[model samples]
Structures are given as C-alpha cells and as structure tokens.
Target: MRPYPSRSYQAIFWLVFGGALAYCVYGLIVGDLYFVGKSGRGAHLHGVPAWCFTAFVTFLGAGVWMREFSTISSRYRTRFEILFLVSGFSLLVLGWNYSP
Candidate 1:
C-alpha cells in the first residue's frame, strides 16, 4: 500500500499539534496557573496577567509558523513546524506557569 502525500503530512501535522496542546494543558493543570489567575485588578491600576498573554502568544505563534511552512519545500516543512511548535508551546506553557 502507498500513502498519500497530503494525508501523511496532515497526520504528522496533527501529531505535532497534539503534542503541543498536551504540553500546554499539562502546564496549566499541574502548574496551578488557573489559580494564579488570568487577569486582575489592584488598588492602583488594573493589570493584565502575563500568563494569559504568554498562552495567547504561543498558540497564535503556531499560526505564524504554519504560514511560513507553506513557502518551504516539503522536505523540511514538517520537521521545522513540528519542532518549532512543540518547543514554542512548551516554553510558553512552562514560562507562563512559572512565577518568581
């Protein structure tokens, strides 16, 4: 049996996406970032929570990388996108969840 190119690429895309999603979710649940709060107010000025921003950026950055992948040859496209997304999301999740 032979595999379709598009299907194979899509499958790999999803595998990478799933890994990124799981990494973020784990950071969220285990890191207790939920309790840390997404946004809040104080006596002075209301401030946006950094974690929420990080999460947003990580998830959105994936889209940017995906777009770039379209211009590259197939040989490196999947590999680049996979590693980029996985590492980017993982770092974002960990950094967002961690606080000094």
Candidate 2:
C-alpha cells in the first residue's frame, strides 16, 4: 500500500471534506438544520443534535482518509473504507432528511 495519497486524490478528499465541514458550519450559524415533511411539519435538528451529526460525519471521513496511511493490513482496507464511507454518507443523508 502507498504511504500517502496521490496529489489528485488528496485534493479531491480535501475538497469534499472541506465542503462538508463548511456546510455543517453554515447550518449551525443559520440555525436552519431541519427537515420539513410534505405535511408542512418540520423537525428541528439544531444545537447539540446538529453538532453530533456534524462531528460524526467529519470524524468518519477523516478516519477513513487517514486509514489509508496506517500500518494495518491492506487486505481489509478496501472493505473497511467501503463500509465506513457507506455508513457515514448514509447517516449524513438520514440526518439531512429525517428527524431524530
């Protein structure tokens, strides 16, 4: 396994991670982190809940990226990365579209 990501891959990862972090910050600042149902009702996901969700996504992504350079066996890296990515993105989507 490579000790570090290629320049292109690093660039892409940072772009995505930065966007996610920015979006979280924006949502917190605007106090508009929520989801509205078709029935006109809304569920608020601000404050602690928003922070928790943001932290979860942020850390998950960071961990996956950092894991690429770890000393662990490469045999499971791909599987682990896939699992982390899918679960992380799923949670992010769920948080964006659903209420706790």
Candidate 3:
C-alpha cells in the first residue's frame, strides 16, 4: 500500500470532516437541515432533505477513510469505494430537483 499524505493534508482533511459532521449534527438538532428558497411563483420551497444531506456526508466520509487508511484490507476497500460513489451520486441526483 502507498504511504499516507503529509501531516498538513491529514490535518486539513480532519478539520473539514469534523466541521461538516458538526454542522450536520447541529442542523439535525435545530431542525434546520434544509435550504429555503423562493419559487418563481412566489411559493416557499425547501431544498434537499435532512436525511439525504446526512447520508451524502456519511458516505463521502467513509469513502475518504477507505481511501486514506492503509490498515483496511484492499478486498473491502474497492467495494466500499464503489458503494460510496454510487450512494453519494444517487443522493445528489435525488436532491437535485427537490422542491417540496
């Protein structure tokens, strides 16, 4: 397996990861997990749902871990990477036109 990236890179990754996780948690707690938008018809709309946002972040986070960690077996890494990509992409598409 290849070596991990520099310390600074890891630090930055963790920082962003932590921040995203914290934000997700805060949103869930506050019930403000969705974005509010005004429709052309003067109707109020909601963006992505809370569950989709949380799942996307979760899958992406796991994918990052699988890519970075040298300790995990390669056999499972590829499978998980594919799963993550598919899940994240599906979530993105599912939320692309959310307006309910």
Q: What TM-score would every model get versus the actual structure?
A: 0.36, 0.56, 0.70
List model 1 lDDT by residue over 1-100, tens digit each: 2333476666777677666556555555555323233578322111233344345556555654454435566667667667666665775566556555
> Which prediction has the highest lDDT against the true structure?
3
lDDT of 3 at 57: 84
Tens-digit lDDT track for model 2 on 1-100?
4557678987887788898888777888997666568797886677656876776667687667747554557767767776677666766666666555
Q: Number of clashes in every candidate structure?
A: 0, 0, 0
Deviation (Å) of 43 in candidate 2 = 6.9
Q: What is residue 2's positional error in candidate 2, in angstroms?
A: 3.6
For model 3, name the residue pairs that clash: none
What's the TM for model 3?
A: 0.70
Q: Rate the local accuracy (lDDT) of all candidates.
A: 0.53, 0.71, 0.72
TM-score (C-alpha, index-matched) for candidate 2: 0.56
Cα-based lDDT at residue 49, candidate 2: 68
List candidate 1 stretches off by more than 4 Å: 1-64, 67-69
In model 3, where do residues sit more than 4 Å from their true spots? 34-48, 98-100
CA displacement after TM-score superposition, residue 74 of candidate 3 (Å): 2.2
Model 2 / residue 90 / CA error / Å: 14
